[model samples]
Target chain A: MTPNILEVQNLHFHYPDGSKALQGINMLINENSKVALLGPNGAGKSTLFLHLNALLKPCAGKIRYKGADFEYHKAFLKSLKKRVGIVFQNPDHQIFSASVKQDISFGLFNLGYSATEAGARVEEVGEKLNICELFDKPTHFLSVGQKKMVALAGVVVMQPEILICDEPNAGLDPGNYKILMNSLDTLYREGCTVIISTHDVDFAYSWADTIFILDQGRILKQGTFDQVFKDRRILEQAKLKPPWVFETWEKMIDNGMVSNILPAPRSQEQLYNMMSDRRIMKRTTPKIIEYQNV
Target chain B: MSPNVIRIDHYAYMSPLRNVHPGEKIFFSLSTMLLVLAMDSILISGIVLGVMSLIIVWRAGVKCGYFLKLLAIPLGFLLLGCLAVLFSVSSEGADYDYFIKVGAVFIGVSVDSFWNAVQLFTRSLAAVVCLYMLILTTPINHIICILQRLGVPAIIINLMVLIYNNIFLFVRSADEIYIAQVSRYGYHGWVGQIRSLSLLCSNLLVKSLKASNDAFNGMISRGFDGELKFVDEVFETKAGNIAATVILNCLLITIYLSGRV
Candidate 1:
């Protein structure tokens, strides 16, 4: 496995009102891997993420980024935030500039880049996100999806090592969702570990290679979907419904309709294609080629 | 609520003069406004009004009717002020062009006050349209960019940017709440409308406070370390914008100088 880029070890946090937000949480985020953190509201997802950036100090345990414990000092935090960019769930909150171009350049300017450098970086990210045309537009004039793109571009311009998106696709329409997913895909291709916290099981199943189930201030499970979802009890405890693709994949394996040893399908189309394969390997990895039933 | 409050800002994004440097627009509008005040000539003021109205409608591409409606907003106040200037009291009834029959006083317009009121009215209208010409053509963020470059204090600039960034958001939320209230007949009667408006105002204040806190968190997430740093907007100020400011002001000044105020 690749080296862990971020690790939370028995991290605990509580609000000032004494409400426990995170309780003895442990998790590891490997480098350059797509991770989907699934959780219900008030599950400490936001609190845990805040700890990752040292915005909120963990009450008991420590968070390590690139093997170094996150320091609460100013200098360390500035650098940590520079590397771990967070795309906020609400674009209105994230975007403070009236102009899209200026908003995208905000992070770069904070990092003390020269105006020339910041402008170039902003343009580069805008082009990558296909928001070049929107650069000149006012922030308030943009549609919700377009505003989300601007917010994403603002963080992407920082060129962070890890991009933690809080519900990035929450309010995106179908077209916008595809565009946003494509942008995330491009960022992943460029070696940014893209992590998104989402409630959509099917979306997480299809997209994230690593899945984490977070519940009641603790991480219930963390692994690939195949490893985590194979145990029905854990998912039930987390109150998360299994991704339909995972259910179908399991049913196909149990009925001998597909190779039990084969990998799980990520999408409906992939599952359908698997069912049409002429060669089927049984549970014992039988090397045989025959026309399978349609 | 006038929907135009939000529309006016949004329309600036569609402005044809957007590429023209905001500083130049600021320079042109302010200098011309000052010139109108200094010259106090009806011809120059009239020309400024006509030219600005044309530029806003023709050049900036704001709808003519909408601009006219916006232009009408100040007219009522102008009329009241003009009325105050147009009439005066004299117990001696000295050359009254028109007079009210009051027992011990004559209140009426003299030829001088008439000319004064006309110029005052025309000057005020001209100045307003000039500002509109600036506001409608240049986005507020660009103007804030100019202010930042002009050595404005960072705190004030930050506040301006924040207000510019979120004013429309609050406007939209208020509008949505108003719509939802109207749907439920919460604004059916006059009393109901008053109650609904007050509730909306209180609710908006609370919602805005929450939104602001969240916005601060968002800012913190993006490496905002207390200082509101932003890349200043850079524009390749075309010779055309400079020429327009210099030439148009020169023309207005020439018209002022060549005539008696």
Candidate 2:
């Protein structure tokens, strides 16, 4: 098996207000994988994300990067943060500078890059994200979708190995949603490990290589998308319904419309293809003739 | 957005001179203001005000009506101040050229006091016009960049940046809460309005604190240390523009000095 890029072993965390945010969480995140964390509200997904980024140290247990135990010292943290970049849920919470160019250059500067190098990276990332036009605009006047794009650009400019986003699609309109999803897809294609915590089951089911069902500060189940979604108990415990595509496939199989057993389709296109294949088979099949009718 | 903030920001971002170097604008505004203050001549003050008003309306593309509206904001206070300087209350009217008798007292304006009041009003108005011209042409982001270039301490600069960005956030959150409350009939009456407003203020404060904590965590996750560093776009400084600014200020000063002589 390939070595895990990140490992969480028996991790636990508590808020300053004395609430347990994470409880004995364990997982191995493979490199270059698209991972989705799904849960109801207050399920500690955000808490775990913070721990992954080292913004919050686990009260117990440890986090491992590559094969080594992750250190929490100042020097190590600076390097760790460079490898693990997180975009917060609210753009208002993440964007600090009124100038878009300045905000995008923030992480590069913290990484000790010279101004010229930082400027080049900002331009590159801005073009990749299609936000080069906003470089000179004031962030305050941007719409919510634009601010969200700026916030994502701020972190993407850092070029982290692992990109964790907390609800990247929350509150986005359809057009902005497509833009964000496309951007994440581009990053994933570039061999970046992308982790997203979302409430949209359909999106996770279709997009993720791995799905983690989190409930009440514990990861209820973690496996390949099919393995986790096929388990009714885990879905119930996580307070989530099966993705619509999975549900429709299951119903078709039960009603004998599809006789051949197949794995659940990951997307609407895949499901359509499966159904079309059945229609094509029927069309090419030989038909019986009745001589008495002639 | 509040109408006032929207108006100012709209003009600042859309101004025809927005692409010009901020330093030149700042230099012209500040130097002209200093001349107005030092010379204290009505002629100099009037000329300064007229020039700034013309630039703001014509060159900056701001409407003349809007400029007059902004000017009216401080005119009320100036009039109050000028009235205080013009009117004197005394038991005897011997020292005054004109007086109004109340009962046993006299209140009136003298020629000298009237002249002083006029100069004070115009001077203050001229100073306000200078400041407005600067603000109306240059966005706050450019101003902050200029301040950073001038070596403002990191702590103050960071604070200013955060505050400026969060003002919109706070305003948005506050507006959302206010709308929710109004929908629930929280402001149907006088007492309800007071209660709802107070509740909105407290909720906004809590939200702002939460937002600040989130912002700090986000910063840390991006490798933020004690200092904040950002790249600023290099603005081209034209010698011709600089020379023009200098010549205009010199002309204003020459006019003032010639009048003095």
Candidate 3:
């Protein structure tokens, strides 16, 4: 078995306002897993991410990182925060510095990098994120997409082990969404334990290795994409539909138009091939009076 | 943007005063004020103001008209105080020369006192300009770091942090309040305006208190100890920066001392 990088056992949390945000959540994220904490709105995904970085203290249970208990230890918590850098949903909340370069340096500077080193890191990450041109511009004046990229660079420059993104694609245009996904893929390939909380099921189905459906502060299901997508009932309860390809395949299955012996294709390309095979099969088979009704 | 409210946010680089240590700048302003209070002479204050104004324009890149506009606020208060000083004196042995008398009332003030007022005005203006230059260039976080380096009391430093946080909070709340009020025509008429402003202020105060508490909780959760740790990035005080600061300080002190001679 892979070494568990993060282990949350029976974790429970509630806000001061008495809202239960996380309830008895037991989760183990193995090292280098591109996991998707998939859920609809108010699904406690963000609350879970916050707990991972020790930003929110759980009322019960504990969180352990790499065999070190981090439940109440301040020093360990700070170390864990360094390891698990979270990108908040709204970029405006985190990008408080006057300039993009300064904003990118904020986290690294806090992490004890010398000015020259931090400047180099900021320049490197700024170039990678295409924010070099915005170095001298005031953060508030940047377009929302630019601000979001700058915020992401701020976290990336810190060089965290795990990257948790909360609803990164929510407000972005199509171009920005593609850019964000490619960045995540790059980070994932670099062996970063990536966790993304998103409402986009297709994105999760395409990119995530493991999917966990969170609802009402509890994990409803946890498994591979095929295992999670196979269960249609849980998807209905979580207010999530399967990816478009899955939905199309399911329709063909329900209509008695396709054999149950065929496997469910995971992606659009695979599904297109499956559909073409079915067409070939239909053309070879003689049409009966029942099939002729259509 | 209009000159008044828009002036609050610094626009350009304002690099000349950026490298000066906040503590040193604070001490310099306080010392200048002390000098003005000790010897309120027109010649001394005029020289200080003239020198400071020239430096502010030449080094700091502040426009002359803009600096004059900023000076107008204190100038108004000084005018009121000077008018009171002119009318209230009744001593027969007054050393100053009186210019005019309207029956029993003094119509025109003495030239010496007028010159003294000008001197006081210049000294105060110079000090205020220095402070403005300091804040405009230095980021707020850097200012906090400077204070921490200066060994400011933990409680006072914390208060400054709270003040900085609250300013952003209040700005956010004000924006929301304006949006909500404008939708209802609350800011339209004179009566609506008064009611809206009063309501907005009260709501803002309540929201600010709530936000402060939430922010405190967040800070505590994030291992924010009693003291805030400054980011370890070095602020290079290069040779040029030191030379500029030292030269400015020396010039101001020289002008202040020469007036006594």
Candidate 4:
């Protein structure tokens, strides 16, 4: 079994105004996997993300990192923060430097890297994100999409073991969305644990190996995509629509157009491939025609 | 006005002399400003202004019109201030060489006061020009780097960095709120305009506070302690440029002393 990189046990939290943000939450995030937290607005996704990065302390729970109880000491937090970086939803919130190069290098410098080392890391991340040309540009002068890239590059430069993003695709154009997804994919491929919170069901369905459905500060369901997304009760309770691939696959199966026992398709391409098998279509069309005639 | 400031900052980043060592630029500007302030001669002030203007426009590659526009901003304020030095009013009309008498009052510009006003105007203009040359050619981050090297206290430098970065954030936030209000016809009439403007200001204040909290959390998640460390591009000091800066300062001082004597 893969070791859990992070675990949360009965986490409870409240805002300073006494509003409950998280209530009795328990979760386990495995190492080297793409995890997606899916929920509607005000469903405590962002709160959970903050807890994971140790920005917020749970009032009545414990967090464990690498199978050990997490420590909240300053020195321990510094080490933990170095290993887990977060890219905020709003670029303006995370980017505190007018210079793009300086912003991207901020995390590296905080990690005690020499100036030369930090500069080299900044260059490498800039090249990876294709933002090298924007290094000298003022952060305010950039378009929203460019600012998002810079913010992501700022966290990516740290080379954290776990990279968590809050609403990574929010406000991005389609082209930028694809670029961000591909960048995250590359990071996942390179063995980083990439986690994202999003309301985009299709993106989560297609990308995440594991999905956690959060609703009202509680985990409605948590499992592999096939397990969590297959539960219609949880989806209805969370006010989330099933991914189109799953809906289409279910309709085809109910109509005897495809075998009911086949594995669920997680993407449009996968669904198309399932439907395009000539032998299955040939076998199912006769049964469909007979049923229609009856 | 805010947009114009942003434009100036953009030009600073793109200035041809952006890669020059910031220490050299800071030294040149400060020395020239000191000479203009110390010399107490209109001719020296004029020379310093001319030299700084030439550097900003021709050497730094800032547009001449844009530089003139920037200079015009302070010129208005300086003129208003120089008025106090230029004219005096007195009840008795005997002490002034030049006076306009109205009943028992005299209001005129004396020769001594006239010379002082001229000196003040030129001095202030020269100082403004020197500062502009520095700002137009060097990015604020580079200036911060120079300050850090010059042994400025870390707390002050950190505050400067935060304020410099957040000024843009503040402007952008305020702009967003203004646009949102405008779209909703929040500024339809006098009353609505006041209401909308007030709302925008209050919203900006709240948003800025929230943004600061978020920014601090983000900084902490990246291992930030008390101090802020930023990377700056390496710039080699040029011997020729330094030499030219020294020669120009010496010449300005020489001209100022000669005029004084």
Per-residue alpha-carbon lDDT of candidate 3 for residues A1-294, written as tens digits (9 for 90 to 100): 889998889999987436899999988898998899888799899889877876667899898888788854545544665688878787755554456786576555445578899999988887777778988887657888887888788788878888989889979998989898888888888888999998899888877888999999999999887789878888988999889987787777777677544666778888878777855234446656555554
Tens-digit lDDT track for model 3 on B1-261? 133423434522344666565555545555555554555555555555665567667766666677787778777887777676554454342544764544665455577667555565565665566566555445576667777777888788778878877777667656554543332223433654675576667566655565577888999999988777667445655565456546655665676579667
**Which is the leading candidate under lDDT?**
2
**Candidate 1 lDDT, tens digit per residue, B180-259?**
33322234346555766775676676556556667778989999876687678789777777787899899877777777
lDDT of each: 0.81, 0.83, 0.71, 0.82
User: Candidates 2 and 4: which is better by lDDT?
Assistant: 2
Pairs with steric clashes in candidate 3: B42-B115
Arrange candidates, best TM-score first.
4, 2, 3, 1
Off by over 4 Å in 2: A279-294, B1-261
| lDDT per residue (tens digit) for residues A48-149 in model 2 | 997888767899999999977888675676677778888888876666555789767766755667889999999999999999988888866788899889
Error of 3 at A76 (Å): 1.7
In the order shown, the candidates' DockQ scores are 0.01, 0.01, 0.01, 0.01
Candidate 4, residues B1-261, lDDT tens digits: the string is: 235577678878888899999999998999889988888888888888888888888888887877888888999999988999898899877767788988878998788988889889999999999999999888999999888877899899999988977887677677655543332223444655676676566557766766677788999999999899867657898998889889988887787667667
For every candidate, give the share of true A-B contacts it also has: 0.00, 0.00, 0.00, 0.00
Q: At residue B91, what lDDT does model 2 achieve?
A: 93
Lowest lDDT sum, 10 consecutive residues, model 3 chain B, at B180-189
